[model samples]
Target: MPRSHVALACLVAIFWGLNFLAIHASLEQFPPLFLVALRFTLMALPALLFVPRPQVPLRWLVGYGLGFGTLQFLGLYSGMAAGFPTGLASLVLQASAPFTVLLGAVLLRERLTARRALGIGVAVAGLVLVGISRGGAGAWWPFWLVVLGAFGWAIGNISSRLAAPPRPLELTMWMAIVPPIPMLALSLLLEGPRRITDSLADSLTAQAVPAWIGLAYTIVFGTIVGSGIWVWLMTKHPAGVVAPFSMLVPVVGITAAWLVLGESPHLLEIIGGALVVGGVLWSGRLVAARGAADPAGPVDVGDPGASAHAVEPAAR
Candidate 1:
């Protein structure tokens, strides 16, 4: 890949990394569930109206929406609001890579390399380390919630693999259509209509300015623009060459949270986070090496919405 394209890939990582802070800001004023519903609602509108439907099956699209659109944000926003450190949430979500590989092996009968298995073990160990460090201090649920969100993201990766839509960005946009109604229903059931109404009513006020800005950043930059560049890069290069760039996201996330949010993570969390990123990068490097050596090997390293039984990019 050219240096310019590689930089574009890194740029996507930065956008997604900063997206965690955006979500944290948006959750300050919007109820987590309602925020999930609203995020998708706005995203789905332009896609449904102007974009052509992706040439994919309905079931896979629905599955993508449920897992990626609905379950992902449902756990992520709630977890962050529940006090999961933004930096840690970013770290934990990388677990989706191993989870996707594991699920693909089990559900899709995909074979895993020894390196893949080892990478997964290291990532899992990292999670355990973080869990022990946090749980020892009596704050554990938030960590688990983000893990659940990561699992949901893994599920989305699986559905995306199965779907294998021709136009990935269009498919991703259409997948947004599946989550709004269900998420809205969930918001009504859990957060209540009063909470939703109050959030909307307050949106016009000065207090909601930051929240709206955060939401716009998330929708435009995080998902749309970030995924757009990701898809374009994948089209221009081999998947293995392109996929490893996502590991940069957690690094960017941690730094952004620490700098902007004044978050200072414990040493243990930092160590564990390093292990997680190191493991994923180890696996990603192996993939890249394999692809370079054998042109016929697995070329499908999963991007945000384009893959088939491929590796995950911590697609948040």
Candidate 2:
């Protein structure tokens, strides 16, 4: 990969890392489902008008939306609201890599490499440590909910691969159309209409300024600009080259949360995070390093066993 594309990948990682902080801040003002509803609503509008619909079947599009947009955010936002720390939530979400590997092996009939299997084991151990460290800190259910969200993300990855849309970004944008209404209905049923109204009302108040800023960051930087750059980078370089950069997301997420939100992880949590990061790197290092050495080799985007690191936006 060129130095410039590497820099752009790092930038996207930063935006995704900062996304956790924004979610944490925004959750203070909006209920999880309601906030997600608003997010997709913002994502779908205006841009949806300008961007042509992706040339894919409706089933794949809807599957991508439900898995990625609806289920993933629904679980993640709720988990954050349920007191999953910003930094840890970011690290835990890296579970998606392992989850994606396992799912692809089973559903997509992709072979599970020894490295990937080992990576999954190491990451699962790290996740166990994370659960142990955080078990007493807060409600355990939320942590599991976030894991569920990670699984949702893995499901979305499979959907994306299956859809194989010509334009990944447009698929992402068009898929944005699926979540808001369903999420809004969920918010009404669970959070109640009165609470939703009150939250919207709170958005107009001075105290909600941070929430609004967070929303803007998520909509503008996180979704539009960040994803656009990601798509461009994916086109420019092999997915193997671009995907490893996502590993930096947790580093950025942890650091930004500590600096901005004053949320620091416990020593054990840090150790566990290290294990998780190490596992992912170990899994991808072989393929990515090979790709780096032979830049002209054809890249395999479909083989999750070999190209797990090449997938775009594992935690997005």
Worst 10 residues of 1 by lDDT: 300-309
How many clashes does each candidate structure show, in the order listed? 0, 0
Q: Residue 60, candidate 1: how far off, in angstroms?
A: 1.0
Instruction: List runs of model 1 lying over 4 Å from the truth.
Output: 1-9, 228-245, 293-316
lDDT value for candidate 2?
0.76
Candidate 1 lDDT, tens digit per residue, 108-216?
5555667767776787788789888888877788778888888787777667666666677887788889889988998999999898899899899998899999999
List the lowest-lDDT window of 10 residues for candidate 2: 307-316
Tell me how far the alpha carbon of residue 90 in candidate 2 is from the true structure, in angstroms, after superposition. 0.6
Runs with alpha carbons beyond 4 Å of true place in candidate 2 = 1-8, 228-245, 297-316
RMSD of 2: 4.5
